[model samples]
Target: MTRAGRPTRTVLAVDGGNSKTDVALVREDGVVLAAARGGAFLPQTAGVGAAVDVIAETVRQALAPAAGAPPYADHISAYLAGADLPIEEERLRDELIARGYGGSVVVGNDTFALLRAGARDPWGVAVVCGAGINAVGVSPGGEVARFPALGRLSGDWGGGYHLGEEALWHAARAADGRGPATALADAVLACFGTATVEEAVIGLHLGGLQIARLHALVPPLLAAASAGDPVARSLVERQAEEVALLGVVAMRRVGLLGEPCEVVLGGGVLTARDPLLMSLIERRFAECAPHARLVVADVPPIVGAVLLGLDRLGAPPEAYERVRAHFSGAAGRAAGDASGEEVLTAPAG
Candidate 1:
């Protein structure tokens, strides 16, 4: 309890991604008082202040029904997208602290959340292939390894957005006789409702269609690959290679390649569980790191944030189980709800 005779909120756990931000107010005992989801946390594009404001607004909505006041939690565990470097994490941490949102704050790249969410132990590797691609590893002794993750400029490849662009590129070339004809041309035309790949290209170039809409092409591209389209299959194969390579290299850097370790795979692309892609990824890992175990994260990344917060608070083991059970039940209910919103909360008792 606080000096005000109210229960202390132990952690304001946040998992902010490129598309959405999830916030949960968790007690030291693992009871979740309030939770909410909000818009993108794109610090790179929206500026640090604006990106944090999104989290602030979402927190306000979450805390509205709960019995709390300023300094809602003892600590803030914010694992966020766009915080790809130590400097970026520091900037965001400083901003959250300046706002007086919590008594203390810790910020890290979202890949860390993915790692904690999926891996059975605290130390392992995580590879995220979402709108962008990145990898991170943590050693038992607290050493860290990560990538610049600046997309192609940083020697990175394979993500849903990049795959979509590749689909478009191949389709356009095939239509123009510059590349071998493949079903990707038909897939692209069907995806954009265009008569030809050129029309879709023109639409993208002239702003008739949002460039982000290209993400929609990923599903069709995967479907084509599953159906054995040579060009599509090649792209999927390359993506699998990149995913496996990121995990293998991170494990090697952290001295886990020769040891038994879990390689947690998260992000939308990996979670989709496309059979062909999964098979290829498994094969690569089997050949490269036989001792490594690959696991696709079954829970949302916010669970990792909550767990990290609990870890910082030195909460008991039961606290961890309580939080995991809460989210697991919430996920089950969410599957049945038609609203499609990812909100989870438990009434104060």
Candidate 2:
């Protein structure tokens, strides 16, 4: 909706992750008309049908505020977690286009969004540590470096999921006196409310306990590390090393290791601002890439989606500024307002 009889130009942007997905309808001038957030849309985890259904409904609601206006946007940008490979991105893009989601659809790994959102230029590295770990780098000349990120099978490591599993392994080993004694065994037992680590492990194997819930153990493991637990501290240090290594490798591949480079850290574990973890990561980077500018992303991933969309649309500079102001002023929560709905929706404006 625009002045008297004019229809405004808009872009449909999406940032889909493992746990949540955010969609936005942004006008050419950067006015966010509507926004919506929903559950995961990962085809690998949710199946293709359910993933499409969830993504479609989420986008529909995001465009609901402006009813009869051409629903067609000048461009659409979708950054999704499971769209790791180029073929995967192309398939998803075709699906979105088949549904008439936009005039043109562009899809890429969600980590690229994290990278663009935190760094001003395309030349930098981004390491995301959340449900999983991923890294991407872009050089000044437009070359890129990225990982498959298909879990341990792909030789990838370090994330909440992996850290929690490591915690379980070390705790179980300590409980059986096969490894050095540490506070993790007691902490792990306390986290699961079990009498002992053995009970917890047995319950997990017998399906009495949820293995998916291991991600919740990350905080406790880090807390144990902060409390001087040797095993826990070692786990945390290893994660930091892994993160730094990912960034360094990406930088080296792009021939930016010797030059000053921006290394962006994002996702759940990194965004938590854990002192020991952050400091250890800094130490690791200091030893390898001394000129690295490490930045912990403060903006939401959707912001990156919108920024990319704006670039595609060739929107003016002020357009991007308006969008940034809206996000930053709202403290980066797109759904900061309550619209009196039973289910929460991220505010589009």
Candidate 3:
């Protein structure tokens, strides 16, 4: 509450992804009170209730030292992975509201958070190529264009995990003489510390080595591509094509194809800024959507979640600055500082 004795408006902002979850408590004036990180929010595998439970635990940790009690915030802005369909988002929103975490709730695909985080304006396109791939677009008139993003079933590809599998596929085929020999064979073997690609494949199949480690192969795959390995370069080129295609299609769908539009790119793969992949992406966008201005997201998606909440509360520009400063400053202190548990006191009135 403010020193004037009026009730304070707060926002419970959450960004949950396949890798981790981030929660922050921010006053309507943009003062960040607390933040915490938790496990993945996998609604498909863990079920909707269990997935939200993860967020609940993290929110509890963030608010334990704060001054408020239940319904800690005026609104809950949750941008989560696995909330792909409108039905899924609705179900999650209903569940969150049922918990009475806040007076109101808004749930959206995490790609929306990525869009809000990077785009110069509220309306633009966001393409995230992290553990998985997805795209979302918002038109100036408030029209939204988004994909189902159900992986292969939804005609999506070119994420870290998928690239890893592709690298192994080509390497295994090359090792067996079924495909053209390339440097990826050796790169794959070295990535897994195995003498042969076959050993890595067998290990993955037998669960001796975790399949998640496949994501690690992406670096070597990109390196091989950068070093002029034909097979690796082809894979990277394909990934670039897909990324540009998603953005272009989204822009076309939203009637931004001929006009100038911001194409915000995020996720681990794109953020790595590999020379070859980025170059190819730029070229593809140039050819396909000439006016598309590509921008790599500089801030985490959690910031977007907070911004969305602030937008809902009709926060002022000063509020936006304060929230950005807090998270950006925390980020500068340590690479992973923002993801750790933290509680802060609001400034004196």
Give me candidate 2's TM-score against the actual structure: 0.90
Q: What TM-score does each of the candidates earn?
A: 0.92, 0.90, 0.92
Q: Write the per-residue lDDT of candidate 1 for residues 1-349, one digit (tens) a residue.
A: 5524665558999999988999999998889989999999999999999999999888988987663556778999999999998999999999999888899899999999888877767889999999999999999999899999999989999899999999999999999999988888998888888998999999999999789877788889999999989999999999999998999999999889999888888899988888888888888888888877788777889989999998898877888878877887788744443221222121222
Can you write out model 2's per-residue Cα lDDT over 1-349, one digit (the tens) per residue? 5534566668888899888889888987888878889888778867656776777778767766554433457688888999988888888887877777688889989988887777866569899999999999999898899999999889987899899899999999998989999888887888789998999999999999998888988998999999999899999999998999999999999999999888888899999979899888888888888878888777788888888888887777888778776776666444543210111111222
Clashes of each: 0, 4, 0
What Cα-based lDDT does every candidate model obtain? 0.87, 0.82, 0.88
RMSD of each: 6.7, 6.9, 7.0
Q: Where does candidate 3 stray beyond 4 Å?
A: 1-6, 65-69, 333-349
Pairwise TM-score winner, candidates 2 and 3: 3
Candidate 2, after superposition: displacement of residue 167 in Å?
0.4
